[model samples]
Structures are given as C-alpha cells and as structure tokens.
Target: MAQASAPSGLRFHSQIDYAGTMKISSHAVARMLGAWQAGPGPAHQRLSDRLRLLVLDGRLPLGAALPSERDLATALGTSRTTVGAAYRTLVEHGYLATRARARATVRLPHATPSERPAGTESATINLSFAAPPAPVEILHAAYAAALEQLPRYFERHGYDRYGTAELREAVADWYRRRGLPTAPDHIMITSGAQHALGLLARTLLSPRDKVLIDHPTYPHAIRTFAEARARLLPVAVGTCGWDTAQLQAAGRAAQLAYLIPDFHNPTGMCMSASVRRRLRLACPTIIDETMTDLALDGARPEPCAVHMPTAVSVGSVSKSIWGGLRTGWIRATPSLLERVEQARPATDLGTPVVEQLATAVLLNGRQTERPDALQHLRSHRDALTEALAEYLPDVHAPRPAGGVTLWGMFPEPVSSRLAAIAPDYGVTIAAGPRFGVGGAFERHIRLPYTLPSSQLTEAIRRLAQARLALTQGATGTHTPAPVA
Candidate 1:
C-alpha cells in the first residue's frame, strides 16, 4: 500500500514514499462518526468503539490515512488526549498502524479462534445475504448437461477474456426476450454483478469524479465506487420513491450514475414504468437488474433499457437461480463492451468455464425462473413480514413487489448497536448503515427472506430478545463481520 503525506502543519516525518495513498479528511470522518458519543462508555472508549465499527463495516478503507489526532479531536469536539488514547487503543488491537509522528492508518486485526463470537458454531440464521437457494434438480441437470458439451472447447486455450460464446448469446437472448434488442457482441460475461460494477468503475471513473447513486443502495456498490476514489452524489429514495428531477439534476454534473430500479436492493421497491421512461439522465447510467426475476406480485419487469436505450444493464442469476453459480454479464454497446474486455484482464482473466457452460444451459432452458421457486420466495417474504409484525411490532417492513429483501425501519436509531449484539442471539443481520454513506440509515436494516419460513420466524424471535436486551442497556461486546 502507498503511504500519504501529512496535511500541512501536521508535523510528520517519514523516509517512506508518501504519494498516491488515499487520506480521508477530518470533517468527512466526523460526519461518518455521527453520534459516536451516544453509546455508553468513557468518551475515549465510545469513540474507539465507533471508529472500530467504521473500520469493521468498511466505511474506513484499510491503509487510508486518518486525520492527525489534534485535527480529529478538534473535528470531533473532544480533547486531544482522548483522541490519542483512542488511536493507541486501536493500534493495540491491530486495527490501526502508526509510526512515530505519522498518522494512523486503518487495518484489520489478525483473526484468532477466540475472536469468534459465542454461538457462532451453532446454527445461526443469516439475513445478511439476499440470495435464493439452489433448485437441486435443475442445478445438477444443468451441470451434467454442461459436462456433456464441455469437450468441444478442449482443443483451444481456455483463457478467453470474453466468456464462452454459448453463455453470451444466452444472456443476449435473455434481454431480447424482455423487449431489449441485444446481440452477443454487446455482452461481456463477468464473475458476478459486483465484478461488472468494479470493472466499469475502473474503466470509466477518474479520481474524484462524481458518481450519482441511490441513497440506501447496495452496500458493496458504495464500497466499489469509494474504492475507485469517486465522489458520490446521493439522491434519496424516500416513501414516495425516487425524484426524477433530483436525479437528472445530479446526473448533469456526475460522470456516471448507478441505479437499481428493478427491485432495488434492501428496499425492494421497483421503479414504476412511468418513472423509468421519464427519468432521463445526462450521464451514462448502469442499471442493476439482479432482482428482476424474483417478482412475487406481478410479471417480471421489462429491462430498463427498453425505455432508456443508452443505459447499460448488468444482470446475474445469483438471485434468480443460485449465488454459488457465480455467473453474470454486462449488456452495453459493443464499443463499450470492447473497452470492458480491454480492462478485464487487470482484474480476472475470465469467469470459470464450467460455470459459464452451466449458466448457459440454465439460461437457454429457462430454468432460472421456476414457478415453485417464486412461490416459495413469496411464502418466505410473507413469513418474514409477519414475523416482524408479531415480534418487532414497531418496525415497519414494506412488502416488496419483487426482490429477496425488505427494508425494515426501526422506531429508533439502534441499527449498528443492534447488529453488534445480534450474533450472540443466533441471528446475523446486515445493518442499515452498511448500505449508505455518511452514517445514514441508522434507523433501518435490510432483512432478507432467503431463509426458510421457520428459520425466518425463529430469527425474528431471537431478534426480539436481542432488542429487549438492548433496551435494558445490555450492550454486547462484539463487532459485526462484513456482509455481502
């Protein structure tokens, strides 16, 4: 990792090269540390816990230089001694690295068996990842069929940056069936939708370039764009949903925009066709269609590009089929795809060959969408909402028309605190703040319906107990692990 110079007047001396490393500003860190003093503890302890959470949850990137202790103390309205003690505590825990006169940089502690949360060995219901379970027969058959066809490509080197021809056309046909005309030439296979987003960010965004995003969007997308060094322009998606005027205004100044109009993650609110057609943007938009096939209330949505032809669509069967398959593709102009192919080698040579063949089989056979699976998902979604109502009555969970998760709003801002204690109760959740920037969504959490109804109900039951413990001022000593 590259080192960074101390800001003017900080007084740091180092022989190490200090160029190209990212340094988060004091004010920015202050904003992300919203209400760090709200939790019970000594001021230094509270600040340290909150800062550790920020690092653990990935708000602070590892190797990024922190503000000088004095500057941070000033920004945080605390004593410099308090700041110094917190930094020292972090260093002792291996969450930060510091040298004489140099600013502390974020790092993760080395893992030990004792570090595992209690009850982790037990069966824990995980609501952190929103993905469907595999259709056993369908998956097995697809792979079996793929093996029968695999020998045809044996004569050549298996290092095609562009994925196999079979899968590309199958993906193209997927869009064509949904009213968007696509050719295989316009498609480029990726490991997954997240990979596609990273590739696009690398190829297109320059440092400090503005990228527009939905507030309370996908967590990994937030991380990807931030890692690319892009300045995010967030447009809120509130109860009434997206504001086209606000999006267009932001888009006019942004270099790129990313939207998840089709069953938007966490919220699971699908953008109306009217909004889709009227929502024109000044910048190139990447539309995530990962949840398009999980519609429980209506027919599947048409591709967003049907209305906005210039939009780039990224889709994966992770939600529709199984996450383990790890197959996804980008739908864009051939010229744009050519650029993606050129940039692809820097990240990964290609997605796995057998997986591509299996995915191609699944797509061609239309096995990704099964009525039984959709029905099961609908049952799980209903069960999760019912459980929330029965146990956590004050938490309002909206029934999504599509998608695998719901955004649950708590009566208070206890999201991060709740997540820290949730694992001990045998349920792990993706805290709401993980999906947003600047410490927003503190009163919300993303609840996935991926588990079976019985397990979902049990998870909620445990969550209710956790909340009760939290209300009684029982703060568990645990840091949340990363979420998908």
Candidate 2:
C-alpha cells in the first residue's frame, strides 16, 4: 500500500495505491455504516460493533486494509480520536491488526463477545449472497407504526390469500408511482418475489410448456419453472445489453417469458429504451423489477411492463428495503389475478397481515434508496471492480449503474472449481453454473457489491488466494455462516 497526503486540516494519511494490496476509499466506508450514522450509545462502541458485524457477515472479507483513522473519521463526520478508539477496540478484540506507520487490516477474532477470549481462530467467509442489511431504525419505525393499524385486521379471517386490502392498494400505488397505472384488483401480494414466481408458475404453466429466460438468469427462477415441469428457453444477455429481437423471437414459441429489464440481477445490465419499445412477445410475460429501486446512477427507468400492458410484473422490497420483509406482489389483469388467488390456497391460506401492514407502510412511504445507500453501493461497486482488476486482471467485470451484484467473466470454466476451493481460502463463492442450466455459464460468476467496500476488497483478495491454492492442489472444507 502507498500513502497519500491527508485531506487538508486532517492529520491521518490516505492509502492511494489500491491495485495490489486491498484498500477502500473513505467515501464507501460511510455508506456501509448505514444505521450506525449515529450510535444509540457511545460512538466508539457502536462503530466497533458495526465493523465486527461486517466481518462476521462476510461483508468485510478478512485481510482487507482499513482506511486511516483520520480518513474514516472525516468520512463519518466525527472526531479523529473517536475513530482511533474504535480501531483500538477492534485490535483488542482481534478483529484488526495494526503496526507502527502501517494500515489496519481485517481478521476474524478467535473469540466473539459471546465466547470467552482465547486463541485466534480461522473462519470461512460466505460469498454466496449479496443482500443488503436492513435500515434498522427505519424498519423499526415502520413496524412500530404498523402496530397502530393491526387492530383493523382483527375482524378479517386473516386467511385471505389475495393479501390484505391495504397492502394491495399500497402495491398498486407503487406501480403507479413508477409510471405504470395499476389497480389493486390487478395486484396480488405474495410471500416474496420467489413465492410470487412459484405461484404464477403453478397457475400459468402447464407441464412441458416452454418458459423464456435470460441465458444467465436468476438461479431460483430456473428452479421454480423447472419444478412446474416447464422446459427452459434461454435468450442471451451479454455485455452489449439485451437483444430485443432475440427475446421477441423466443417469445413466439414460449408459454411465458420471465425477464429483468431494469437492473437485471447477476448481470446488472439495463435494456435500452428503443429495445424496450421494440419488444413484442406472443406469450404472457412475467417481468421482475425486484431490483428497480437500487439504481446508483441515472433516473429510475420505466418498467418494461409499461411497453406491454399485458405483462405480469413482479416486485418486492428485498433489494430496496430489506430481504427479510417477505412481501412481494404480482401486477397483471384482474381476471388473471383472480385465477392466481384460486390456485394459491393449495400452497398457503394467505400472507401474514402484520408483514403486509409493514410493507404497506414501506411502499406507500414513497421511499427511495437513502442517499447514503446509493453512495455506499456505488463505492462498493467501484471497490469490487478495482479489487478484481488488481487480483484477477484477466477476468472481465463491468461497472454497473445500479443494483448490488456484478457479473464477472473468466477466461476458462473455472467457476465451479473456484467455489469448491474458496472455503479453503477462507471464502465461499456462488459458482457460474449456479446461475445457469446444463452446465452453462462455466466462464461466469456473480459478484455482489452489497458488502462493505473494505470487505469487498478483502473478499476479492481471498478469492485470489483461493485461485492460487487451487492451482497448488488446495482442497476445501465448508464452514458455518457468520452471525453477529
């Protein structure tokens, strides 16, 4: 790592060279500190806990360098001594390593607060996901607010499978706000986006039917359609973005199409306006906008459903708000929704009313990604790209404008092998084949920028190590998912 002059009036230095050794810009650190913007108790203790959680959650990969105390303090808008205290606390707990005139690096402490202090222990970092941490304060507020409205639902059977009326209206409003006029009658709330897909697949798909999907698509969706006994039809989505003509052509022979036009997961690729307009599919379509609200740059694009009013749109707060919300909706014709409602009872009676109430509050709140969150995701994305550039220069990773994950392409079919060996290097990765069918996508893997920038850097460094270890005949043993 190389040092650079401190920000004027600041005493600590910044690490400028980031290619070989892991380093994250101060800007990104602030974003990852979401709810910790102001601690409920002492600043240092809260900061220490937050950093520890990042490491435990695999958001901060071990071995990544931490920004200088002064640099982090400036970014947090706090005093330098406050950051110094936090770093010292981490060092004491075995979460960080520091020496004279050197940057602090991350490590998993042998003992956590729950465990008695003892010898340092090693752990494997889970990289199989990219979900965001909940905005604790905001979520608590919503739930507290939900309590007030809970009494009104006491009169209903609470087994209404179409979802609570309040949430349905709220979801419709969400679509309208997105520039697509929607009716509550056309919306049916489900457990989550996956649940929404499962229900739709059950209602709309017949055995042996063909379902069109992006070549490299959401892994869960592939499983969902397959479970319903549908054959998969894939249209390639590549670096140049979607090929509208190819999709429309694939649509003709398909029973239905599932697409992620905005903030496409795994790829983080967005379709062009002309392409969106030119697309005309022959079958009913299911368009997923679960990642719509995560745009880091450019205005929120119009939903692909806008171009085809008959398209069934699926969305959730998983990305924009929190994945644990367990609330999602499907937007389509009232008659179609009516049929879905009839089939849904076979799976479950209905969604939970309290969960619906909280999501109603979230959806109707007209909330956008917090300024801190967008900045945080952008910073993490840049950090991930930079890390790959340094450690795996041969791999190609495109910088995305929005969403949490990045799709990385390697020169060979090494993704499965990488996943198998990553645990040995103290990291775990979702292989390319996990995202595709028939052993396809062997040259690709998805990298999410949802982790802290420092963790993103560290995780990449661990990945580089895993690659080398594999070459040296390293074997792996899986470990537990960290919880703090």
Candidate 3:
C-alpha cells in the first residue's frame, strides 16, 4: 500500500509547474487530510499543526509538492507572510523539505503527540450532531429511584456487562410494546447506538467486506464501518423514502446493510412497510430506531423491524428521553444475540450498571413525562419550517411527518460555505455533505428543532441574515438582525 500524504495549510488546490516538467498542487494533499479546517490555535500554529497531521496521518504522501506560498495564503484567507511562517515551522519540525527545485515537498517525522490532528474548534451552530438537551430534573429523579433499587443487587456481582437480566427483559418488553415480539434472550445492552454499531462491525465484518449504507445516513456509522476496514456502498434514498431498487442492488453486492428506517438522520424520511419487507428479503439488516419515538405533529409510528423478522433493531433513549442515559440495546435473533454477547466484553466489558438501572427505572414508569420538553421541541420545529419557507423560499424544506430536524436544500452548492459561516451569528448548523458519503448533497443543510422556541427563533433569524450576507459576498463580522 502507498503511504499517506502530508497536510497543508489550505483547503483548496493549487497547481505548480515543477522543474519545467510535471505540474503539482496542494489539492491532492489537502484532499488526503479529508478537507479538515485547522483547529483553534494561534493562526500560524493552527496552520502548522494541520500540516503536520496531514503528513503524519499519511494523508500527504512523500514527494508531493506543497501549494505555492501565494496559493496557500489565498486558500487560508491569510497573508503570504503567514503562510511562509507556517511552512517554516513545519520545515523545522521535519515535516517538509525545501528542495532545490524551489517547491516544498512533504516528509514525515517520528510519530509524536503533536502528530494528531487538533480537535475541531469551529464556533458554528453544531446542528451536525442531531442531539437534544437532557431533561435534567427528570433524569435526576430516575437516577435517585434507580439507586433505591441498587441495594437489592448489592450482594451479587454489581457489574454485569451483558446487562442486568432485568434491563434486558425490560428492553425486550419495550420492543414487544412497539409491535415486535422480542425476548430477553435476544437482547444485548450496549453503551449507545454507536457502541452497538462498533460491536457489530467487529463481530460481523472482515476487511473490505461491503457494507451498504444510505446516501444521506448517520455519519458516525460510516466511520465505524470504515474503521473496521469495510468498504461502504451508498444507496440513494428517495424524497419519500428508501429507493428499493438501489437498496436491492447494494444488498446483492454487500455483506450487510445499515439503515435508519425510522425518521432518518438529516432527511427525516422513514421507510414504508413495503420497502422494509424488500430490505428484509435483500440482506441481514441493522435497523437504527433512535428517532422512532420522537414523532412530532401527531405523526403515526411506522416500525420497520416489524416487517423484517431477521433484522437487528437498535434503539436508545438518547433521542426519546435523554442523551445522558448512555443506554441502548440490539434486538436480534438468539443466534446473533449469543455472538454479540461473546463480543461485548472486548469493547466495554458492558454498558454501565448505574445508567442501565436508571434507564430501567424510566422504562418501568418511575419518572413522569416532561410535557414542556416535547412542546418546546414541536414549536421549534414548526417555527424553523415557517422561517425557512419565508426567507429561503427557493430552498426545499420538506416538512417531515415527524422528528426534530428540518432538511433544507438550497439553490446553490454552498452548504459547506454556510456551515463555515453560521458560527458568526451564534447559531450552528450542519452542512448536507456531512450527512452523506463523499461530497454529494452539497445543496442541503440539517437544522435541528431541539432548542427552546426562543432560541430557535433567534437561530432562524441569524440564518436568514447569514444567507443574505453570503449571497452578497460578505465575510467575517456582520451585525445580526434582532429575532422577531
């Protein structure tokens, strides 16, 4: 395998004619870094750190020509002097070489802590993760009630990784109430949906085994599969629902298919009963039901797993109740259950006993519903959709039957550009590209209606202002209009 390339300061490409021969540019090098922005640091330090990560991460392979100083400056929106300083810093750090040809080339130094890419520190409104705030009082009460039951298990081994049999039974019963016949023997409690996915990846996938995913799917699942060395094949999801033809094609080519059959992330599209049946016939599936219970505007529930007997159903209280619960489970066949049980310890030993017990308490009716939270989320969703219709009229804001996000499509391919600018107005939003594989869906943005109505209104006003400013070629600071 070829070594990875080095990182550079800029996000765009720059072509340079080298030694009166072949042309080289930073595009390939920056592409290797996955187009990450330099994290928060002093301007030059951030630039240098990003460059080093690209090199160390094998994103910029050896002998690749760095962008010219002028091109680097333009790409980063900084002065050539600043780009020069950053290049000098990297050179001193042994990450690049100033060759006789006068074009800088990438080189790798010994791996060190500085080699890691700096964490994302962008201040944009982070609608990227479709998370809602926890109901703190309700969660606290649930925990208290759980502690009261804790002493009963004190004499026994307090830590059970496969989850307490009680919680497993509760999960099974939870599914049964949802119209699926699940049993405790078929459930494996996990830390969260992501953890459960990771366990499944490790257990079921081998290097380069094809895993089918939807075009605009949950991104973290893609990462999990990629880390497990599985090749991802994305099938397009239609405006109404999953594309059955593409799904069947992918299933024929892949070993597994990961789906969000209930209120999909970003799109908010749910799979119909017919399509779910087709998917079941196609392959063994992993159906994520995190947003299944989060219906808004009196939307009816449509459970996909109910139509697919062989499906592995993944659910969590994160979307329905509180993200702080840190509890989720996989409902599958008893055979798959045994396999997951054997693989669970290698990831986390098991989900936390305390959190599981608290979740069980909530499941068992110890806590009351917070009407205010649901009402707030619903109002926010409505306000956001109305705002989008009024301001971004050209954009397609599909009113999802339920769920907390509004997926809007712009007339232009500048969703990433908008994401880069949203932070200035104190509102964070996710670009459509972040939700899909490769660089598709650049015209989209996912806005969550999980914030309080007042904040949601203010956020929409800021977004309108940002959209106007972007169209007019303004960057950096702008006075935002007051939320009406």
RMSD of each: 5.6, 19.5, 10.3
Between 1 and 3, whose TM-score is larger? 1
Clashes of 2: 2
* Candidate 3 least-lDDT 10 residues: 1-10
Model 1 C-alpha lDDT per residue in residues 72-178, reported as the tens digit of each score: 99999999999989999999998899988777888888855333234344577887888878989999999999899889989988888879999999999998888
- What's the distance in Å from true for residue 98, model 3? 7.9
**Model 2 lDDT per residue over 1-484, tens place:** 1111111111111233645556655655664454564535788887876666555433345777888999899988989998999899889978899878878988866742332112212464556777888889888988988899999878877788788889999988877888888888888989988899999999999987888888678888887886686777777787788887677767887888999888887888877888888777999999998888888888788888888888898988888888898889889898998999899988987888888999998777755457787888888888999999999999998877688889999986666667655665666778775565544565787888888887777788888877776667653323223210
lDDT for position 9 in model 1? 10
Tell me, by lDDT, which candidate is best: 1
**Considering lDDT, which of the candidate structures 2 and 3 is the better prediction for this target?**
2
Tally clashes: model 3. Answer: 15
lDDT assessment of candidate 1: 0.84
TM-scores vs. true structure, each candidate: 0.89, 0.74, 0.74
- The local distance difference test score of each candidate is 0.84, 0.76, 0.68
lDDT tens per residue, model 3, 262-292? 7788777777767776665466788888887
